[model samples]
Target: MNITSFLIYCIIITFTPGPTNIAILSTVHNFGAKKAMEYTYGATIAFGLLLVISTLLNTILMTIIPKILIVMQIIGSFYMFYLAYQIYKMDTSKPTVNQSGTFKSGFLMQFLNPKVVLFTMTVIPSFIMPHYIAMPTVTLSVIAITLIGFLAFITWVLFGTIFKEFLQKHKKAVNVMMALFLAYAAIEIWM
Candidate 1:
């Protein structure tokens, strides 16, 4: 496998402004980096698990029930919408304490996110050569991807943290924006 190609793939997957990153940003702005990092940690684990599952079941998925992927997609989108609502309703005035285990929110969100699933199905396969690549190598690749994903999310969360000084003044606007973002993600799933 070409290292550059894999690196490029990781960069794209990690940096994209998807639901996971959006949630982290919102959480950071409303709660703070400490809470947001929890989400990132959870999300990273979820990401690694998804990759491993996909790699192990690649043949099964590639052959049988490829279409059932749509189900995962729909479920994921709905979850995103639910999370968006939570973000929209967050009480920015009171910084929320991290009640969910350090990474519960981030972990579950990333684990269940359809967007991430679709991305994994689409991109991960390209890097993996089923014939040449051994399972151990694929597992390592997944781990690398997960680490990159964690860092990318951290960057977005930090962006929110930096913007908090300005965003705090306009909490209502941010809520509306979060609501709109959720709606857009849901609509995309249907399309």
Candidate 2:
């Protein structure tokens, strides 16, 4: 495997704005850095779990992947729309950490996020399976990828923390913008 290319793909995919990242940013903007961190931890755990699942399931019948992808895409898209609606209506005036920023929410979101779902499904097969067939090597690869994902989540949290004041100043506008981004991502999965 081209380590450079693999790393690039992992970083770019995890770091990019998507449903989970936007939610994390919105969580920080509204609730606080602590809430966002909690969400990040959940997301990171789910991410690693997904990687492991993909690795184990890679040997299954390739013919069923298309069907599985379709189901995931539909579920993920609907979930994104639901999240977008939640963000759009967020009352930033009364700031309170709720279920939205909880670890469980973040963990569940990963399973319903198409960007994350697709990334986990493809990354293992493309990068690790191609070069490293040993179980230990594959386990290490998953850990490294999970770490990269955690770093990406932390970066988003820090960004929200750093710009918390500015983001809160225009909280309503920011939420709407983030909502639209999530909606756009949901639509983009098909094309």
Candidate 3:
């Protein structure tokens, strides 16, 4: 495996704005850093689990993925559209004082996110599997990927936190932008 290429791929996919990152940013913008961290931790745990599962099931996935790829993409696209609608409809009249980010929310978001699933499926099988067949190497790669994912989550949270004031001041604009981005992502997945 070309480690450099693999790493670059991982960085690009993990760092790009997706459901998880968008959620994190929104959470921080509305609820603050502490709440966002909870979501981040939950997402990180989910990401790690997904990485391990993807690595362990590489062979099985190879056999079944071709059959399910279209279905998964369709489901993912619809889900993204739903999320976009929700974001667009967010009530930004006031800060959600009671809306502390929950671990379950973060965990479920990543667990159900098709983008993350696709990322794990493709990256592991194509990059790690081809180059490192050893269990140890695979494990290390999973750990590395999980850590990188966690960092990506943190980056988004930090961004949101830093701009919390600005976001709150222009809540409608921010929400609309995020909603549009999510919609675009959904359409892209289908295409």
Candidate 4:
């Protein structure tokens, strides 16, 4: 694996504005950094697990990915739509109406998110597997990749935290914009 290329790919894909990051941002904006951290923990665990799964089942995934992708696409898109609805109606003034920012939600979101699913499936094969076949090396790579993903998740939370005041000032607009971003993510999965 070309280290630079792999790092670049991981950073771009993980740090990009996708459903998970947007969800984290919305969670931080509405709730707080603590709630967002809870969500981030779940997301990070799921991300690492997905990477491990991809490593263990790389060939099987390659054969079945098209079919799996289709199923995940439908499921993920619907979930995004649901999240969009939740965010749109989110009122920070009211107590937590739903548990969208909970650890469970974050964990499950990774499984249902097509972008995450695809990245986890592809990253191992594309970057780690080719260069290193040793178990230790592969495991380390998985850990490193997972760390990269965790950083990305945390960055979104920090971004929301740093701008929480401004976001809250225009809560309605921010929520609508975040909601629209998620809905757009849902729609983009098909295209």
Candidate 5:
């Protein structure tokens, strides 16, 4: 595999603002660093599992990916739109009492996030499958991707912690901006 290109792609996908990253940011801003780390750990584990599942199912997916790609994209777009709306409607008046930063919440969020799903599905096929067909190579790639995802989660949480006061002061603006980004991601998925 083109390791450099693969790394670049992984970095871009994992580091970019997405539902998981946004959740981590919001969690840190509201709950505290400890809670945010719990969330991050949960998300990281889920992401790793997803990567493994995607790798294991690669052969089956390759056969059907073309046929289901459009459908998956549509589903992913709508899901993103929903998330955008939720972010826009987020209540900033009080720190969320909704357990938004819990480990379970983080796990479920990553599990259901279409952005992660699509990233896993495409990355394996496009980057790893073509060149690194060996089982050991695939396993290593999955591990690398998972670690990158963990780092991304940690980075976002740290950013949120650093800017927690600012986020509190400008909660509305932050929510709106994040909502808009998610909306754009939805549109991009469709395109």
Candidate 6:
């Protein structure tokens, strides 16, 4: 359990710009950072749930039924498309005044995001030595990865929060940015 190596990989994966960050930052610009926290919490929980499910199933099911990977990939892709639609519709100008739904939405979006699943299933597991590592050790390594990922996401959300004012002030620019984000998301799902 080389915690240092795990942390490095986690930082790389979490900090790299992706759908979750795009969604959260846009939400923050529209609704304020406080409201954007909901999405953050949601994403965090979703990540944890995915980690547990994959870890467990990786042992019992994935070994015997390799096709679960394909199912997960398909589900993930569908969810990403749905989220892209959501983002495409987001009116940064008249975003939901009530901040209640942001967290749950963020969490669920992250949970089903195909990109997240792909990275978790393919990239994350490679960092740990499954053959030499015990289950608990592997679990702890994943937990460490989760913690770092969550913190990095929160940081990005905060950056978006701080930039919200600028985004609001430059309405036209913000719209372009949001549109670009939507396009990126669409491409990700499509690919």
TM-score of each: 0.87, 0.96, 0.93, 0.96, 0.85, 0.79
Task: Report the lDDT tens digits of candidate 6 across residue range 1-191.
Answer: 47576667677778877778777777776677777787788888888777767666555654754575566556766665565565556665564666433767877776567667766665335666544468787777678767876897789778987777787787556656665765576466556
Comparing 2 with 3 on TM-score, the higher-scoring candidate is 2
Best by lDDT: 4
Using lDDT as the yardstick, the better of models 1 and 2 is 2
Residues 1-191 of candidate 2 have per-residue lDDT tens digits of: 99999999999999999888898998998889998999999999999999999899887935688898899899999988898998898777885656668999999999999888889989999988989999999999999999999999999999999999999889889999999999999999888
Whole-model Cα lDDT of every candidate shown, in order: 0.76, 0.91, 0.85, 0.93, 0.83, 0.68
Better of 2 and 6 by lDDT: 2
Q: 77-142 in candidate 5: lDDT tens per residue?
A: 777688778778988786576466788878877766778888988888889888888999889888
- What tens-digit string does per-residue lDDT give for candidate 1 at 1-191? 68797798778867977788778877776777888887788888888888877777777788754576777777787787887777777776786676632587777886567778876765567776643477687777777787887789879987988888887788878877977887687778778
The C-alpha local distance difference test score for the whole of candidate 2 amounts to 0.91
> Candidate 1 has which clashing residue pairs, if any?
42-107
lDDT of 4 by residue, 61-177 (tens): 788889999999999999999999988987656666445588988999999999999999998898888878999999999999999999999999999999999998999999999
Per-model C-alpha RMSD = 2.3, 1.1, 1.6, 1.2, 2.2, 3.0
Cα shift from native, residue 77, model 4 (Å): 0.3
- The global Cα lDDT (0 to 1) of model 5 is 0.83
| Superior by TM-score: candidate 1 or candidate 3 | 3
Which residue runs does candidate 2 get wrong by more than 4 Å? none
Q: Which residue pairs show collisions in model 3?
A: none
- Once fitted onto the true fold, the runs of candidate 5 whose alpha carbons sit more than 4 angstroms away are 66-68
Output the lDDT of residue 128, model 5.
Answer: 88
lDDT by residue (tens digit), candidate 3, 1-191: 78799889999999999988988887887778889999899999999998988888878878888766777777777877887897798888855663547788888777668789889888888888877899999888899999999999999988997889999899989989998988897788767
Candidate 3 positional error at 77, Å: 2.3
